[model samples]
Target: MCLKRGRTLLQYAISPAVWLGVWQLASMAVGMDLLLPSPMAVAASLWKLAGTPQFWLSALFTLGRVCQGVLGGVALGSALALLTHFTVWGERIFAPAIRVMRATPVVSFILLVYLWVDRATIPAVVAGLMVLPILWGNLTVGLESVDRQLLELARAYRFGRWKTLRLIYLPSLRTHFASGLLNAFGLAWKSGVAAEVICPPALAIGSRIQQAKVALETPELFAWTLVIVALSLGLEGILRRVVHPREERGQ
Candidate 1:
């Protein structure tokens, strides 16, 4: 077990070392900080940012936007899914809207939504809009895929709506729900960041990245990019911990 764990750790370390070596070589070859900063320069910039209160506040604001979008999107999407799943009229009304949301460009939404909301809130709103269609589609598929025989049996057994949902639909939704959330988090972050970049929020990672670009702070920009990547990976880790165990058991 110890050997296996050590090997796993070594593999993890080795890949990054290899990539960093390549990056350093490329940066050295370029010989311009403006174009491609070395790993050391980027790391130094990241350290400098880490020591600032501004960085923390920006991270916090972006984190809130991400959470707000993801949670609201999931709730709204699931509700719409339930409505559409149960009634033909519900499907008729919502299906086209959901499809439209999915098909629309994120930039288009950002431009249109900017007219309705302020810059600070636009990231959250855009993130939510990106998530809604994903959850709605997954849920629609999940609900529709539920066993009709089991549904019939539940009805014949005089099970009420709530009971039927609790027993049948919820269980059926497990995989789809987890899948939606895991996928939605990434979508939410990307859309949120894109909105921030376009709108330039007061305090956000995206705002920092945009400023870094405007200033031609390549190392700082790379460092900020790394921060976003790290956050995404961390969120994925948390979701995996929460969702994977249940999936394994279901299997």
Candidate 2:
């Protein structure tokens, strides 16, 4: 059984290995690490980064900003969604604004925000703005999707608004909220870090990445990118476990 499990794991790993091989070959063909680094080089750079206190500090700083932005966005988006539901005029007023935000280029927002705030806070605000529309839109749709018949039944049973919201609206909205969070979290991470790279906060992963780029440290740049991807994936995994534990238990 141990051997079989090991073999299964190896089988699962093969595809990634093959893809990495192709990437390394392409990088070698280009003969410029400045453009594209090999997997081994990135791994080595990552190992070096893992040994540094500064690396940890920078990573933590970025992580805190991302978490703060996500939490703030979720709260504001949920509140806005509820308000829009309560008043048709609110919906009409907010919908076009959300659409405009969604349509605006992220770079434009970053530049605009940079002019107003310092580097450290710009990432958080940019992340929040980027995620707000996604959460609001998805949650609004989720609330709308709640069964009208079930709502009528709740009313017939004399369920208060709060009780109905807790028992009925919440369960129905979970999946939509989950999807929104998953999408927004990744987007927020990328855009937030991009903002940071441009703004160069005192101690941020993006600042380090920007330095790496300026110094032509391709391996370190790739390593930082790998770290970002790892963190994003880790957060997503934790959210999945916490948000859908019942689904796992059922399985």
In candidate 2, which residue ranges exceed 4 Å CA deviation? 1-4, 249-251
Candidate 2 has an lDDT of 0.91
lDDT of 2 by residue, 1-251 (tens): 99999999999999989999899999999988889988988999999999999999999999999888888889988888888987999889998898899899999999999999877999999999988999999999999899999999999999998999999999999999988988898899999899999998998999999999999999999999999999988988888888778876796
List TM-score per model, in order: 0.96, 0.94
Residue 4 of candidate 2: its Cα lDDT?
A: 92
TM-score of 1: 0.96
Candidate 1 all-Cα RMSD: 1.7
What is the number of backbone collisions in each predicted candidate, taken in the order shown? 0, 0
CA error at residue 245 for candidate 1, angstroms: 2.5
Query: What is residue 159's positional error in candidate 1, in angstroms?
Result: 0.2
Among these predictions, the greatest lDDT belongs to: 1
